[model samples]
Target: MEQDTLDLAHISLRPFQLSDADDVMVWATDERVTKFCSWEPYTSKHAAVDFILNITTKFLWCRAICIGDRAIGSVSVQSYSGDDKARAKAAEIGYILGSKYWGKGIATKVVKQVVEMAFVDLPDLVRLEALVDVENVGSQRVLEKAGFQREGILRKFLFLKGKSRDMVMFSVLSDEIGA
Candidate 1:
């Protein structure tokens, strides 16, 4: 199907299930989808199972991006837990989509839903942010279209994929929504 004709209304987010390992592999094995992600492309279904069984349970908020109940990707919000008072009010958002689903506007729709849902679901959260690799223009556009403000770059802030990368910080404050 054509990108423009793809009905984004079909997109939805739900908790990851152990049964999603096969679907998780759809994007988990695609380097194109993991290029800007911190983790490398998964090489086995066991890794996907481990992610679903162990990793997904650790996030403050994590969900599978589904289309009519089929997992295509994931989105999550991670909070700085413990006694860090300064960081307690803030959390970071992250997401990934299968390479086959790119350019379909599925991500932007999912992101917008997550943002609205996150603020409500996590009431203590006053700020939700995302850091995008400078070279990942597509993701940057996704965040921008989802209403996040582009903050300045953090030069050499993160060392990922064997190199120090400059990252663009994007954020949406709770007060900024429905304002």
Candidate 2:
């Protein structure tokens, strides 16, 4: 499936462009930003841009979250997760914003919009999950605020920041996501 650029009346969601690399690198590659994430800090701008483009190209739906015009970060909902792939009716939501934009409620708001898009725009999708690091309390709150219920913990589900880490799973089904 091809990636579709989604729009939210005020905050537009589009594919990542090469120009976003410099600014994205400044924040996304910081140790503080990737501290609890499942990946290491990128050393160069090309790495960041290529990473975004590579993932965005494969997913059916991915968004470069934008505020006004600047691409502030990314929000992606893949067609399915490992176990959910057999269900053929679920998607997993993941996102990241630069550190400067943290605590602004922007991530929560954008995530809410993505939830709405999944339930309203996609007819076949039944649910969406947010896989957040167990230690990322702030992000867990964001998922909760966005209406995703805590499903459970994924034990040693991902190797991030040099070691295996657990993840708290949150999910919102189609029927539960209000339009």
Candidate 3:
């Protein structure tokens, strides 16, 4: 399904534009922001521009998490299984927010919206999953608040910042959301 701009009370999920490179760099370069993320901290505006031009543009389900006209973060849903319709429909969700916007419940709000869109608006999707760094308590709480149940830990599942890291898996099924 096409991802249109999603409006929320304090933030909006919109397509990333090349002009947002500066705003994106504001958070992308921060060491704290990339501490637990899979990608290294962006070292220049060119890197941010490349991300907008290359990565975000190629993914139909990725969006810039915005407040007003500023792009502060991103969220995406990716198919975990290939084009096999008979398999249980599933997708993995991932998100990141500028540290300044953290702890304000914005992530939770964004997650809840994505959950609704996945289970209610999209009929083919039966489950939505998230893998968060074990040290990221804030994100863990956000997933729990959004009604995703903690499934288990994925040991050395992701290599980030030059080291292997463990991740906690969480998921919410369509029926769990009353879809």
Candidate 4:
């Protein structure tokens, strides 16, 4: 609903807009950001912007992470409806940041705000889960800093870069809020 920029002092999270497509292109296509991410390198600026515009209107939860006025990363959630558990007011989250910005706590801060927003925006949203590639230790740490717990290792649970990769299932339940 509200993709307006969110300011939490050190970092800000905003909606991914058509205008941000150009800024997004700088990192979205980089191997460091796309390797473990859901999508692959964008072949062109137009293609990148097209994707950003589409993501803006396609889902209930999506955002562009910004530092100052520049787009540095992105985070989003996809709804699951096939199963009772999947559709019980829950969704899976994913994210990536440019390698140039790595080792900073930007991702952690953005994730925390997004998780809080998810719970507030959707009252029944009892849980938010993230499937992190097993080798992505930095990503795992981001989830933990955001208050998500690693439930288990999902063996070959995801396909990445044309191969089956193990993933760590991390989640945060409603009852665990502020715990």
Name the top lDDT candidate. 1
Residue 42 of candidate 2: its Cα lDDT? 86
Clashes of each: 0, 0, 0, 0
Over 4 Å off in model 4, which ranges? 1-10, 82-86
* Candidate 2, position 61, lDDT: 81
> lDDT of all the models against the reference?
0.93, 0.79, 0.85, 0.81
**Model 2 TM:** 0.85
Q: With candidate 2 superimposed using the best TM-score fit, by how many Å does residue 161's alpha carbon deviate from the native?
A: 3.0
What value of lDDT does candidate 1 attain over all alpha carbons? Answer: 0.93
lDDT of 4 by residue, 1-179 (tens): 11344344646788877778788888877987788876788879987778786765666688888877677888887777556664767788888787777777778888888888888888878878999999999999999999999899999887877899999999999888877
List model 1 lDDT by residue over 110-130, tens digit each: 999999999998888899999
Candidate 3 residue runs with Cα over 4 Å from true position? 1-8, 83-88
**Candidate 4 C-alpha error for residue 69, in Å:** 1.8
Compute the lDDT for candidate 3. Answer: 0.85
Can you give the lDDT of residue 152 in candidate 4?
96
Worst 10 residues of 1 by lDDT: 1-10
Runs with alpha carbons beyond 4 Å of true place in candidate 1: 1-4
- lDDT tens digits by residue: candidate 2, 76-156: 877865565576788888888877677777788899888888777779889788788898999999999989899999999
Candidate 2 residue spans exceeding 4 A from truth: 1-10, 81-85
- Best model number under TM-score: 1
